[model samples]
Target: MRDVIEGFLTFQQEIYPNRLELFKKLAEAQSPKALFISCSDSRVVLEMLTQQGPGDLFVIRNAGNIVPPYGPEPGGVTATVEYAVAALHVTDIVVMGHSNCGAMKAIAAGQPLDNMPAVSHWLRYSDSAKAVNEAREYGSADEKLNALVHDNVYAQIANLKTHPTVALALDQGQLDLHGWVYDIEAGVIDALDGPSRTFVPLAENTKVSALSTKLG
Candidate 1:
């Protein structure tokens, strides 16, 4: 707690002053470039990862970075997605998973979650991802974990499409969706390539194959 306070004090006194004009302009309104959805893990400092400053990336951090399919009753994620797309007009949405993600690790391992009922309920949103990984075979524990992480990212991207606002923006070619898995130790991001349906280095996954990039 003391560290958090001192961190804030440092930002308030020194860091904030350096970007005061940018902060002042941001105080009026925001026009973020992207919607970044990722795990609520302390190691995942997205601002540093993307090198994006204030008002650049509208973010949603949750366990497993899950986005449940849009339902008749809207939830926090659904509402946030709607606002980012319809109101803020973000052009890109990224669903990022990470290596050694506790949530995905639990879901893939099917670890008992009885004591943590709320966590179990929340993780159900990624059940489809678990099912997908289960359908395939892997040689080792690391392979299984890696597959699940990428699968969960893809699953969330599918869920994003189910949202009406996201769907509309996509149909009009105004928005793009990306799936990525950050390797903690390697300090690299593997992005999903739509053409190949494979995870490749971020730089290699250059083109975004949107709705039109499908086979008949």
Candidate 2:
């Protein structure tokens, strides 16, 4: 807590003044270009990773970076998706999962979440990702965990489409969807390639953005 306060103090003294103009503009309104949904991992800093400034992204974070299928359940994820699409008019939605995600590892190992019932229940949204891992034959736990991380991103992107706002925007070609996996150790990002249907170095892929537009 002391460290957090020190960080805030530093931000207030050094960072805030440097970006004062940006902050003032943001205070009025935000018109972000992308909606970034990623896991609630301290290591995964979306703003730093994307090199995006104050109003560049509208973000949503949660355990396992999961987005439940649209239905009766009331959740912040559902509301954020709807607002980003219908109200904010964000053009792109990026669902990103990181390597060695704790949530994915726990489920892959069948670790008991008996003490954390809420966490266990929330992770049910990622059951599809677990099923995908089960169908594959992996040689190691790490491999299986990585597969779940990637699969979960895809699963959430599908879930995003289930929302009426997302569905309508997609139908009208006003929105694009992306699936990404960030390698923590390597500090690299792998994006889903539409043509090859495989994860590839994001820098090597020029077709991803264009492909997303077409998929809309």
Candidate 3:
């Protein structure tokens, strides 16, 4: 906690001053390129991982990186997705999941979360991912967790399409959706291959980002 405070002080006194002019421009308006949805895990730092500064990405982080299917009731994730697509006109959306995610681990292990009722309810959003695990056989905990991480990213992407705004943008070819799994220890990202329908090296994940900026 002390280190976190000290880091903030360093950013305030040094980093913020260095980028004062940039911050002033950002204060006026933000033109972000993508909507990044990921787990609210400390190991995964958005800006640091993407090397994106300030307003490059509109982000939403939650326990499981889950996005509930658009329905009668709208939540923060739904609202953010609508705003990023409809208002900000972001062209790219990335749903990212990381290795050994606790949320997925709990689901995979069938860990009882009786005390954490909200978490229990929230993880229901991952029901589709749970289905993926049910159809497969895994001999180890790591295998189960890894499979959950990858499937969860894809499941979330499917959920994203249920949003009217996302559906419209995708239908009109105004948006590109991406799914990703980050390997924390290895520092590697596996991007979902649309054609192959498999995860592959994500060396070109940011290709759409630059083009989206121009289009936006």
Candidate 4:
């Protein structure tokens, strides 16, 4: 706790001064480039990893990085997506999963969430991901975990499309969707290559092969 306070002090006294002009501009309004959805793991710092600062990415972080299908059940994730697209007009939506994700591991192993009813219910959104990983052949636990992490990104992207705002933007060729898996140990990211149905490095000239990309 003290460390966090000190870090904030450093940012306010040193870092903020250097970026005061940028902060002044951001204070008036924000027009972020993309909607970044990722797991709420302490290890995954979205800004640090993407080399982005404030006003660059609108973010949503949850236990599994889950996005429940757009429907009667309203949630913060759904609302955020709508506003980011319809109002903020973010051009891209990135659903990211990471290495050794606890939620994915639990789902892959069929670990009982009996003690955590709410968690179990929430994770149902990623049930399809578990099914995909289980149906495939993996030689070891790590491989299975990796597959689950990647599969969840796909599942959530499908869910994102269920939003009317996302659907319309995609149909009009105004939006792009991305699925990514981050390797914590290696500090590398693998982005989904939609056309090839594979994960490839996220870099310049690289494109995501997902519904939004296909439609856009």
Candidate 2: pairs in clash: none
The full ranking of all candidates by TM-score, starting with the best, is 4, 1, 2, 3
* Tens digit per residue, CA lDDT, model 2, 31-125: 99999999999999999999988889999999899888888776688989989998999998889999999999999999999999999999999
Per-residue accuracy of model 3 over 1-216 as CA lDDT, tens digit each: 999999999999999999999999999999998899999999999899999999999999999899999985445999999999999999889999999899999999999999999899999999999998878999998998899998888888888889999988877879888888899999999988765667878886544221112222
Off by over 4 Å in 3: 204-216
For candidate 4, write residues 1-216 as lDDT tens digits.
999999999999999999999999999999999999999999999999989989999999999999999976655998899999999999989999999999988888889889999899999999888888888998999899988899899989889989999989998989888899899999889998777767888864365556534764
> After TM-score superposition, what is the CA distance of residue 144 in candidate 1 from its true location, in Å?
0.5
Which residue pairs in candidate 3 have backbone atoms (N, alpha carbon, C) closer than 3 angstroms, thus clashing? none
As a whole number from 0 to 100, the lDDT of residue 33 in candidate 4 is 92
Q: Where does candidate 2 stray beyond 4 Å?
A: 209-216
On a 0 to 1 TM-score scale, where does candidate 3 land against the true structure?
Answer: 0.92
CA deviation > 4 Å runs, candidate 1: 72-75, 208-216
**lDDT tens digits, residue span 129-153, model 1:** 8999999999998899999999998
Worst 10 residues of 4 by lDDT: 204-213
Candidate 2, after superposition: displacement of residue 21 in Å?
1.9
Give Cα distance to truth, residue 192, candidate 3, Å.
Answer: 0.6
Best by lDDT: 4
| Backbone clash numbers for all candidates listed | 0, 0, 0, 1
Alpha-carbon lDDT, every model = 0.88, 0.87, 0.88, 0.89
Candidate 1: clashing residue pairs, number:
0
Measured by TM-score, how close is model 1 to the native structure?
A: 0.94
